[model samples]
Target: MGGQISVRGVTHVYTNRYTRETVLALEDISFEVEQGEFVCIIGPSGCGKSTLLYLIAGLMRPSMGEILVDGRPVTGPGPDRGMVFQEFAILPWRTVWRNISHGLEIQGVPKEKRDEIVRHYIRLIGLEGFENKYPYELSGGMKQRVALARTLACNPKVVLMDEPFAALDVQTRITLRTELLKISLQLSNTILFVTHSVDEAALLGDRVIVLTRRPGRVKEIVRNPIPRAARDEHTMENPAFIEYRNHLFYSVRSEVQVAEHEALVRG
Candidate 1:
């Protein structure tokens, strides 16, 4: 079953290692992600979208407030939460099957069971034939599919993605988006996806969380009106999708402008 996430008044601060200069990244940010919910977070560059994910992943501690996964406070990285990064962080030496089975191996699952799980995910990601292929031999999209399959094989309660599709080309990105949506629906995964594209957010998210400029705060949390089953290529042409996309684009653009101005001032 998917886990519910509760982020209560969370704030994060970063300090330059050498200069010891502190900067506020996220401020008083609070939100909730229900079990099996697909939540996408969008914000201006450096507005701490990735930072927020790290906080929830327990990779870093929030300066203030708390992040809870299924009612338990996040203290450090755990198997209950899985993260997929922009970079395809799969092992180059491992074949697609091996990469997908890595997590299950870590859990000490028997080879027979691990093989079964890995094969299932390979089919899930449409990489059945490429199971023997190494990372370098695969396309960018295929590698990401391997990475995602690896994460999903662990059966994490919540899946966190940090621009997982941002590195792909346009066509590949679109293709993977649909594949991911299908897989998510099939698995009923609880996902927290962070992206810079408003259209992507509109297409993939049950709710979109927009953040303000530096010292990022929750600007708004917009619920997607389009039903998940109805979200497809044709859905982009629908008026409701356009309206949601435009609303998010404008909201994010405003924050981007503010961030640029602040950068100029700092310069």
Candidate 2:
């Protein structure tokens, strides 16, 4: 069976010892991600977008509310949720093959089985002959490909990405973004991507969710028409592209002011 995610009214708050203050990271945030849906989250910096991702992944618990996957409550990190962080979280010491197979190794999959999946995804991510290369040997884009390949190798139910393409140069980021759409669709896994780019959200997400600032709350959920239409290069620069981008732009802009006001009160 495929996977679906449902995040109930979730809120996250942090207590600061030094300041003797309670910081609200996410407040009354609620949204649901259907099976095989590619959803992107965008907002101002420190608006708790990443906090929502961590809560959904069960890396940490929400101060309140519940997160569920396939009708089960998430209490801890599991194979069902795969994460790709921005800093190319791959280990430097391990060779490409070892890093990709790390998750399967943890679950004690047989050598033959693990090797087969690794080999398949190596080619899937276009890392065909770079098996023994170290992370230091790869370029920024290539390293991120390895990160994606490693996450996909585990066969997770959904992938959570936090600005996976944020660090690359202009040309590399664009090329990888185009390729990531292909890789994501071919793998057929549910994805929740977090980013600050309106263009990226419009291009990649079937629906884009915007959040308010710290103590983040869901502001709007917009369905991107292009991905639902004929998928092509020209579709992104189409007339609707500007319209969709503006919808998110204005939505996020309003939230940015809200976030700033909250920040001032807290400070």
Candidate 3:
């Protein structure tokens, strides 16, 4: 089952060890992601998008407030949450099959069950023929598919993706977005995806949360008017898609300008 996530009055402060310089990364960020929902977060470069994702993943803790997954406080990384980073992050030494099965092995899933799960995800991500190939032998997009399959094979309640497709070329990124939509629909996985692309957010998110520049705060949450089943490449050409894209672009652009001005003043 997919997990519901609640971020309550969260705030984070980062302190540089060497300089002792502290920066407020996120403040009073409160939001709830419904079970099985695909939510996207977008903000300026310095805005705490990835920071918030890490907090939810239990890789880091907030200075204030709390994050809960399914009414349980997230104290640290656990099996219930899976993370796919921008980097391929798959083990070089392991072939595609081995990489996808690694997490199940750690969880002590029997070899037979692990094999079943690994093969399922391999097909789900369309890497059926490449299962024996190592990461170095795969293309960038193929490697990312392996990374994603590795995360999905474990059946985590929540999937946290931090720009999982940012490194791919335009065509590959587009293709993966569609594949991701399909996977999410088939598995009903609750996902929190962070990306800088307004178009991506508009295309994939049921709701898009926009954040301000520094000390990122929830500026707005826009719901996509386009139905999930209808969001395909052709959907981008629809009037509603264009309108949503334009709205998000303007929202993010405004924050980008403010962040740039702040940087100039600091300089």
Candidate 4:
């Protein structure tokens, strides 16, 4: 397993010069993603969920606190931290194999070694047969597999996902969400996933971290200590699963409702 992630009171503030206003996107946010744990953050849209991902990925600096990986602060993006976004984020011009190994290619990995890693991840993501295809020829899910394989090829300590399946249709999202858990286990890597779906969060998370609306803050963290059996949709129909899902839904549902009302009131 890879190293863990420690976010210590990380605050992100956005400033707009035109209005001379400052927006606190995240305030006093602190959480720990243990090694090999699948933790998901969910909240209303524009609530700084993506902002938090940026902080952990070293894409942006937090205004008030620090984000660290295994006790070391993340000053910049590194191989230890790999990300897969909502968009496919693949190079359309490159072949599937080339896109998967783009990171290694950039890192000066030799063609032989890069090809092997590409093949490994292609198999890992079950895209072995499509190695030579272009992303344009693939479905949304297949494109995402290419993206996931690309990130996995880097062999990061943690995989940070930002609503990676949100763009897909309901069925595809559900399928991928389930597959993601399988992928997480097969890789045994730590993951911090951000999403808007309570069902999705509860379905995949080892721990679900709920955040508040704008100026996002951790509201409640629910531990899904019960592991779900793989490939069994029956778990979702189980009373225990229903209770867990409802509990999470009711927990965050009101906050989301309030945020919506507030938005309409402002408009």
Candidate 5:
């Protein structure tokens, strides 16, 4: 079964080693993601968007409350969840094929099976001919394709993306987003994506979770009415698309102003 996530009154606190001061990164954040749903999270800078993603990936524990996957509490990292970061995390020295097979290698999968799975994803992500190229030899978009193939090859129940497309150029980003939509539908993948772009969130998410300023709280969860099969580059011109875009833009704008005010006061 694909993963379903539940967050119950979760709060995260961070302490500065030098200052010995505690700051609340997220306060009483709670939400639920149904299995196979594509959920996008957006918030102002430092509103703990990435922190929340990390928390879900089991990279860290919440200071209070709990997170659960498929009714089981999250304790630490496991194969059930895979993470893709804004910075492509592929090994610099490894060729595309080897990088995609790294996770299977760590899990002690036999070389024959690993090769089979890696070859499948290499074709799935459109990196067929570039299998022997190192990270330094590929473009940013190709490197990210390697990162994604590696994650999907592990067969994780949930895919955690931390602004994976933010670093790509506008054209490349759009192309990949469309490709991702197709892949997720084909695989019925469950995903939780963190991004700053309202338009991107509106285009990609089944539901967009808006967050408040620092000490991030769930402000609202906007359900995207656009069907997955219907989304494409031209969908931006559709009235429904424009409405969703406008709504998210306004919702996040208020939080952006609040975050700016807080910055000025701190300064």
Candidate 6:
């Protein structure tokens, strides 16, 4: 079964306790992610990229409208919708292998079966040698890999990522992006990635969804014409990649300017 997501006229609002004010985070947000499609969301800071992810993940609900996965309303967080955050949420005390097995253990998968599944993903994420290492002993990328492996180990239908690679160095981010692309294709999991980097969005997303500054709303949803099979080093050098990157860059830059202008006006 493929993972398909539908968001209909979603509007989310929050209250500021200190200021005793209401904040409109997302406004009239509407989009649909097809089964097995990879979609990236990018926008200016405070544009509610993460907020949208949270809504879709059912970590919280929109003050209005609804989010559906596989035609069913998303009422709460479930194993079908897994999330990987910027911070490596892996347990520091556990070894990489144990960390990956944590979810399976919770589900009461037998030790032997859980270990088998964990070993496969450890190898899949290139943590074979470091399986015995704890989070502190691993680099940022490796720690993130453990987190990824753990999430994938649960076999989630739709993976929601909130800047999972933002903290990594440039080289590490690039390498992991490639690895993640490969893994996603192999697994055919639907992904909704929230990112600030235009290049990253263009490179990984089948379609890039851009939002306006604050009170985020979909500004544009640009389909990547570049075929996934062609998105290699050669493709990066190709004109199409540069063109798409520039396209998204400009789209986001305009919103960023508007945000800055509003900030200046407030000041």
Instruction: Give Cα-based local distance difference scores for all models.
Output: 0.92, 0.88, 0.93, 0.86, 0.92, 0.92
Off by over 4 Å in 6: 17-19
Which of 2 and 6 is the better model by lDDT? 6
lDDT of 5 at 6: 99
C-alpha displacement of 64 in model 3, angstroms?
A: 0.5
TM-score of each: 0.97, 0.93, 0.97, 0.94, 0.96, 0.97
What's the lDDT for residue 247 in model 4? 86
Candidate 1, poorest ten consecutive residues by summed lDDT: 180-189
Give candidate 1 regions above 4 Å deviation: 262-267
Model 2 Cα lDDT, one tens digit per residue, 1-267: 466998888989988889979889998888888988999999988889898999888889999999999999999999899999999989899999999999989989999999999999999889889999999999999999999989999989989999999999989988888788777767668999999988788888999999876768888899987764355456667888878888898888887877678779999
Local accuracy of candidate 6 as per-residue lDDT tens digits, 1-267: 668999999999998889979999999999999988999999999989999999999989899999999999999999999999999989999999899999999999999999899989988998888888999999999999999999999989999999999999999999999888877768778999999988889988999999999899999999988977668645678887788889999999999998889889999
Residues 96-207, candidate 5: write the lDDT tens digits. Answer: 9999999999999999999999999998899999999999999999999999999999989999999999999999998888888878777766899999888889988999
Please state the error at residue 60 of candidate 5 in Å.
Answer: 1.1
Model 2 CA deviation exceeding 4 Å by range? 257-267
Q: What value of lDDT does candidate 5 attain over all alpha carbons?
A: 0.92
TM-score of 4: 0.94
lDDT of 4 by residue, 145-203 (tens): 88888888888898999989988999988888878777777776788899989988888
Q: What is candidate 5's CA lDDT for residue 120?
A: 94
The TM-score measured for candidate 1 stands at 0.97
**lDDT leader:** 3
For candidate 5, the clash count comes to: 0
